[model samples]
Target: MNIQNFSVASLLAVITLSGSPLFAKEQTQAPAYEYGMPLDIAQAVRIDEPKSTVCEVGQATMTYVDTHGQIRHVTFLQQTDACAIQ
Candidate 1:
């Protein structure tokens, strides 16, 4: 094959390989809670049932009152049965 054609083929191969999930690194997610970490929930209010999106699963947004009387917003994941404080 000609140099021009070879270069185009090599470019396409590189693009396809780079975009493949097999070559991509697995993303690590942070745990919901840490060991020995104290979390006191004074109150919890569910905002609504969120619609599922491409990047995010369907979850509910909740407002919470902590031990210190601070209001915090958390996303409750139904699949994991856990809440992530935002």
Candidate 2:
């Protein structure tokens, strides 16, 4: 039926449009910081900590400028803020 064809076309169109951004959102991933990794941060540009109310561990990210003025980001795991308040 024509209605079935239209529904299929609409579904395909919606799927195609929604799928593009998921790939674009993954532009680049930051380097994960490990224990004993030497860090010499010059100026911290921004810090994005996980936003959660649960008292659990989460991943946090920080953007900083190195001594050479190169912008970089690093990811690390830390306890959420909810744990600190308790």
Candidate 3:
């Protein structure tokens, strides 16, 4: 009986792990950034913003890799265009 129970438990574990998202073929998108949200960034990948001659408020995007090695991007408002000249 004990051997049979062990076998059942092992089988269940295998099934659960197989169906888990960790083993999933599809990758889900990361959550959008918010105020005071902590980000575990491993490395930056890219940045998207408008090009202008003067400072302006525009939509900006920052692409980076999280600590889990997953690629993610955050979109927010930022000052784009050329740098301020002294």
Candidate 4:
């Protein structure tokens, strides 16, 4: 058995296994051209029913169904309420 080679490999394995934040700095940096935005805030709300339509108010788009099961889409100037459905 090669004792020297076994010891050297064990030392390297220990160093690599210890967590180091500095080693991950390069991975955390965002690219130059790519920008970040709040994806949850920008998502469009869809209400499914029998009748609905699609409408575009601004950047956001909403889709829903009317009383008669007609699909409709509408955009809002401002988001009045946002609550997750249970």
lDDT of 4 by residue, 1-86 (tens): 69999999999988887746556753453222224522223333473222213332223344645555554454334322321121
Which ten-residue region of model 4 has the weakest summed lDDT? Answer: 77-86
Q: Give per-residue CA lDDT, model 2, range 22-73, as digits (tens).
A: 7775567888999999887999999899988888989999999999998878
> Which runs in model 2 stand beyond 4 Å of their true positions?
1-26
lDDT of each: 0.59, 0.90, 0.78, 0.44
Model 3 stretches with alpha carbons more than 4 Å out: 1-32
lDDT score, candidate 1 = 0.59
Candidate 1 lDDT at 69 equals 90
Instruction: Specify the highest-TM-score model's number.
Output: 2
| lDDT leaderboard ranking | 2, 3, 1, 4
Single out the weakest 10-residue window by summed lDDT for candidate 3.
Answer: 23-32
TM-score for each model: 0.36, 0.65, 0.54, 0.24
- Where model 4 places Cα greater than 4 Å from the true spot, the runs are 30-86
Q: Deviation in angstroms for 56 in model 3?
A: 1.3
Error of 3 at 76 (Å): 1.7
Better of 2 and 4 by lDDT: 2
